[model samples]
Target chain A: MAPSRPYQPLLLRLLHGLNSIFVIGAIITGFWTYDTYDGRWGRLPLPQFKEIESIHGTFGLYALLLLPIFALYAFRRGQRRLIQPDTLAKLTQVGKPIWWYTLHRITNTVMLLALTFAVFSGKMMSEKWLPQGEFDHTWYYLHLIAWAVMILCISVHLLMSARVGGVSLLLSILDLKFRPQDSPALWSGHIRNWLSQRFKGTPK
Target chain B: MKQNLALTIIEIIVFISIIAAWIIPLLPKLEPEPNTGSLILSAPGAVWLIPVAAKQNS
Candidate 1:
């Protein structure tokens, strides 16, 4: 019999879904904006709409707003998906499953950094710069670099996940199944329990 | 032991890179144009106040 698919936390699925939508939206719009305004290296034949930048900015704004919450969850609750003290050590074990897992963790961590920098550099930029035909701003350059890194990191993240866990793992993240403990209705109680445990120095 | 040292190095590099990214923006006095008169404080902006604006406020 086939093994049962792993279930992800309901909150993780929700946040990950929303975050992916905004991030992908931002990426596509970002490319359109780049092609529209500052295609200094090579220009695409796509139609130029001055409004693409505004659309991209909106996507970026949503992403920026959601990032901290997602990051907190990732760093606090989903810590295993990120780099640990042994991650680098595991990298030396070439051709092993742990190496792939370590690489995946590293990729996840880097993706976070990539997203942070992309949002930051994009934020620092003036909306007027591109409209005015000016593209020499340092933040603009950094944003471009961040975009490239994000794309590469995201691609690697996907590949690494597929490598480590195969297709079932990828499908598992999208699965809506959750345990009673992971229910959204219970989230507030969980938070309260955590807080009480923290302040009162007692187990929940 | 070598692997552990390498891990430390990577951690240091990542930490330094984040710090440098934060600090480099300050060097240029980069501030988003205020919408009205008061600065439009955003979540990211609040995390790192514009160096020039902070200097003026202080």
Candidate 2:
């Protein structure tokens, strides 16, 4: 049999790359901010650091802003293809992982919104915002809630991925020969279908 | 049943770790703030430091 072609879609790859960079940025910056403002709270106290905190917040803001674009893409196109039974089966060898896919979409959407809220609220509380005292309690509560939601969603996402195939599935994004034997043409075809459907009426 | 139990345990552990990370700090605590000037470090700063150090070493 011919070697099964790589299955990752270009758009998926792009979104995954963007999301990875932004999330890593958010994590590093978040830790820095914690170190600066609330290191006492962390189990492993990170040294107080501020220089990157701004960068972290900035990346987080970008991530938050990009989320709506991601969501719009997901809801309009990615959702249909990703949730297809054949796709899920090919991806996980499981029959329609509906719960997982739904949770994934919902969590991702919520995470982006939460991140946005957290960043805005945090900025309000920061020295950057004028009349900073106006935002203290409300900002603090919103930031805390948003962080909590993002953390929980991420944990669920990781755990679900692990359950499907441990680290291999997670790493498969980078592995070229990531597709299973049964469905060789699915990924690229899905992307083409998505683009065509999306641009059907628009001018070339 | 066994697999379900194992998954449950793992879930519980993750949940506990998250809770502990948040709760432990609330308990009474005091420590001197480290001098920020002596060690100028930030989140992404560590990434740059390594390459610079490697260049200097080379």
Candidate 3:
């Protein structure tokens, strides 16, 4: 067979793609919610509403369920793609492309961490906390901090994705083409094999 | 060509949004009175009650 496009796995594509959408929606709507209620640090000029919290919260809820699943898949299959301190130490010794690759992995890890914390803190935060105009809440502050972290992480992620994978890698997640080998029917077997291999040498 | 154009546009929009996100948080905080008798509406984000004002940092 001809060499196919280097694509993300079908499962990762779906999970990560949807997760990306949820994260994007949640973040934008979240800004609206933050602007409408908190806006203590800064605010978007976008129109504000009270239900923005629920909208953002709904996305958060969805992410809380799926992101961990994607994380599991990533940890199992693409663990090497994750950045570690040791890997980062070699960054300066590498070429520019490798540096970009390292940066990309680091940003991806940051994105996952930021998303997890944002959702966790957000779930703990109530609209009442801000509706009553309360600003000293712990969870609320953490959520705000997560927002800034997400911004930074996403900026790096986008830049690295463009530099390393360029548009092809960025667009791959959006590609709907399915190869015969990647058919959904085969996913179950692939997942089973993956799971078996992951546990093959592990101590029970 | 078309595919590349779309991808570039997406990259630009994402880049802009990232810049906006970074900029928005650093601008300034809106000071809300602790005892304002205001029923802050949530969601349906198009609605505005009090004057819509954002503090811009120079």
Best-fitting candidate, scored by DockQ: 1
Candidate 3: tens digits of C-alpha lDDT, residues B1-58: 1133432343344344334433443443334434553333333233333433422221
lDDT of 2 by residue, B19-56 (tens): 44334434443332254222222332131122345446
Off by over 4 Å in 1: B1-58
Candidate 2 CAPRI assessment class: incorrect
Complex DockQ per candidate: 0.10, 0.02, 0.02
Better of 1 and 2 by DockQ: 1
> Which is better, 1 or 3, measured by lDDT?
1
Could you give the TM-score of chain B for each candidate, in order? Answer: 0.42, 0.43, 0.43
lDDT, model 3, position A59 = 87
The residue-by-residue lDDT of candidate 1 on A1-204, one tens digit each, is: 988776778888899989999999999999999999888889889899999999999999898778777876886678778778787678899999998899898898888778888887887788999999889889899999988998998899889989988998888889877887777899988889888987999956
Say what the RMSD of model 2 is. Answer: 17.5
Task: Write down the TM-score of model 1's second chain.
Answer: 0.42
The first chain of model 3 has a TM-score of 0.87
TM-score of each: 0.78, 0.52, 0.70
- What's the best-to-worst order under TM-score? 1, 3, 2
| Segments in model 2 whose C-alpha atoms lie over 4 Å from true places | A1-6, A39-44, A81-135, A176-204, B1-58
Superior by lDDT: candidate 2 or candidate 3: 3
